[model samples]
Target: MADYKSGDTASWDFEQVRRSQSNSPARRSQSGGSGRRTQDSQPPANRRRRKKRHFNVVTYILFVLVTSAILAGVGWLLINDLCAFNKEDITATIEVTADDTIGSIADKLHDAGLIEYKWFFRLFATVADAKDKIGTGTYELSTEMDYRALIVGMHNSSGNLNSDTVRVTIPEGYTVSQIIKLLAENGVNTEENLLEAAKTATFDYDYIDNNSEDISRLEGYLFPDTYDFYLNEKASSALNRLIKNFNSKLDEEKLAQAEARGYDLQDIITIASLIEKETDGTDQANIASVIYNRLEGPGDKGGTYGMLQIDASLLYALPDHTGPITNEDKQVDSKYNLYKYAGLPPTPIANPGLASIEAALDPADTNYYYYALGKDGKHHFSSTLAEHNAFLNSGDYAG
Candidate 1:
């Protein structure tokens, strides 16, 4: 308390100040606290908080990794299942009856190895809204189709392309009887039954009656062409199909053309049939001109001749004629014999094609009255009897 010197009074008391600071509450909180710790106690709290935060972060990271792995595993399993079900094999001949139900068709598909499970196919069809979309008919299935492909094929019309068949080609000149024989030879139908059906076949009398009365049968009107028939088709059906095709080819225009040419429809067909038998090449128009010239030109007398004198007509009249023509065939006796008759035969001898029919109506412009085939199969025409005789005497004459 006494002022000794200014320097002495200003000097610090280290020991006393330290003792007082130790007793202060604020000092205790900053340093080592009392029985209720200060910074030391806060250190324990902070360490506990940091430990909790680290545990939470680690747990969350581990949970996210585990979830990602589980999701990847599920996705891979789903993809594998889909790929396995996409490829399947099928095989068999399925005959779907007209009254077959969807359930029955599904069962057939299962039996044919086209579907792995019937319920699956049924469900798929139902889901696609195609339960009643399937058609009823014979179906051919193979083993290389999958579920989707098989379903599509079942609804596709072209899937029925494969089937058993018998082919018969009726030539352009064959009669109904001959057509029946050809069908029989090809195992398409019984010859007797086919002939019977053909005889009763309905025809357009308007076309046939326009020509002549000699063609009482359907020989020339029956069109000739190749036909494809199923194994299950009946003889009557085949005959009807041919007749229908023939009718389709004979339109009113062709008939009109014949009429315009100063010939009846039947007469054109008759002449066309003759031309078809006389000539093998495409020179039917020329042959038809020759025929008309002979009919109008001078013959043995000054008057017009009445006979056509066609060899094909004579051959058609032969009895028991089974093969090629012979020299004796020209001498056969029948109303169809052109050598004996002065005009065209009663009807067409054979069914003529459209080309021959057109040629008969529109003949070529020529003055030739006679013609004969040469050794090279070319025809030699003559305007008079003397020239025709010379051609007949040539080395090309088959007679």
Candidate 2:
């Protein structure tokens, strides 16, 4: 229906229009290809994220395993070594020398079967820093104690070597000779050595003056009391201890009391010995008064009244006198026999107690001249010789 020019025909050709319409479908296919490339990139990104999560899980598992292994190793070491140490059980005496080193003591412990392993003890000591802390002494170790306890015991210094010493109590009133005899009998000293110690030792000065012929002899001066000494003590040591005890017991007050009285120390001792020999009852002061009165009173026979006629003193004078006194023995003449001598005996006959000594110094006031024991163990006193003769003749004292 329209005439076309040459240029218009070139611009609107039918074949070219058909070709262009087909190219539109090809361009739409290229756009759809871009969406498929985007989907592939998304899959690659998700795979990287999953790989990172898997790596984190492995690292956490390894860390937990390593920590558990370390803890288990520590527990095993503690159970095997530190918790098993204990003392060995054995009966052995461990003598620790003075200022002994830790190594030496450890060796001794090992020798005594007290420790199973000496090195273990050393290790414990090292850990506790107790090398110098261990004491030096005798120790009685038991197997029942742990190693720690044994160490503690050594540090505490609890055991001694001389645990079984013999204790002897020298009672009050024992003479030096008697004490020496006791020492000999008890195996503490020899008789010869004891006698020599008593003689040469200063303890015997109380009995004999320095210038006198009698050098050393202790009679009543050895105070009697219990004494304790080691069985191995020397005789001289025993004597020294006895002297020390006497010095302690004899205070200044008692000495002053003796001096205040008119009697010298030895005289008071002599009277006390006489009083002890004559009486047994609590009325010793009364008996003491009788002896004092007689000393001050008139004599019995003549020539300054030489005879005291004490029956006990006569018995002392007899050489073989053992049993009761007979009437015949009283006639024996000896200086010790108060019946023969004028004053007190040469020395005290026995050790006298303080009470007897005090009684001798301060006798009760009485006028009686003679006294005889009755059948009832009581004394009958008289002022006149006729009364005394009658009382004796009555035979009421036939004890």
Candidate 3:
């Protein structure tokens, strides 16, 4: 009976130990192979490391793709900005402050409609090492210029307008009176100021000094040219430039040649001014020959037709005249009337260009004393007044 009790106690204790082992976590994992949790199959450290590595790879690929897209978009915009696709014909003056930077300049350009993009200009300026080379002043910028040209024009004080400036273009054959009117029209000077200066101011040119008393002496000598004038410029300063330019363009050798040809500088100017009004540039030399022929008289092919009969001189004498002269218009009481005077006009009626001056110095060796305007806008030269009258009545002459 003692042995049965001992066996029962031992069996009960063993049964309690088996039940505790089956309920524990390690025993549950070791007992079932296929029924084990997937996470429990591997070590905790290895499983955590694999999950972290997978997340990092996916994150890295997404970051690379997003970054590449951003970079490509930026590159396309930058390339588009640098190209010369946007062209405009706008002219504007940009006032750059001393404290302005490259980025600010880019903004100014963009606002002026001169450039398409501001950020790209700033980037370009930085890359090209031209950011710090810009100057601080009012710059004359035109949209007609390309991007590169605009940058170059504004770089290093190149297109700086220190003061207000007005550009005046003087066309050929413009007289002193016409230039005064032009200066007033261009806002360079007041009409009264310009005319007073022209009439009273004495210039230091050799051409003006010889005939100093006559204010109109520099009429044809003030060379017609394009000039830049300061706003409200002094009339003397404006006229001085014209005189200086005239002196610069006139060659001393050519003046000496004209003096050697039995004519003075005044004579050459007088003849040139007539040639300038008589015909276009192509017929100046031939027209000059006719003037010399008429003056030289019977020794030339021209007989006793001693009158110049230049209608241009007649028109100049009458300031209010606008159209062709009538028979009554020719009777105007002025020494400039070539029909009555039988010589060159008292003074040049207009400013002559270089071609006209050159033509007067070297005339064509022709015996053409009389010329009439033909239907082709060219002069029909004749040796006699009878032939000139015949051409005037013929169908070839429109006037």
TM-score of each: 0.54, 0.50, 0.57
lDDT of 2 by residue, 259-322 (tens): 7755577776777767776775576687777777677666551323534566666655563678
- State the displacement of the C-alpha of residue 266, model 2, in Å, after optimal TM-score superposition: 0.5
Which digits, one per residue and each the tens of the lDDT, describe model 1 over residues 336-384?
9776667778778888877787788778989777778888777777777
TM-score ranking, high to low:
3, 1, 2
Supply the global lDDT for candidate 3: 0.77
* Model 1 ranges off by over 4 Å: 1-163, 204-216, 296-304, 319-332
Cα error, candidate 2, residue 29 (Å)? 99
lDDT of each: 0.66, 0.63, 0.77
Better of 1 and 3 by TM-score: 3
Find the 10 residues in a row with the least total lDDT in model 2: 156-165
Give the alpha carbon lDDT tens digit for every residue of 1-399 in model 3: 345677898999999998898668877778465665555445678888999999999999999999999999887765655665546578888877657888888889899888887877877787765543455567788767666766665654323445467889887888788888998898766888778777778676665754454556767877887888765655766777787777776767878987886778778888888888887669999999988888766744434455778888887778788877898888877888987777778788788888898888889999788888888888899987688889999999978
Off by over 4 Å in 2: 1-176, 204-216, 247-261, 300-306, 331-333, 378-380
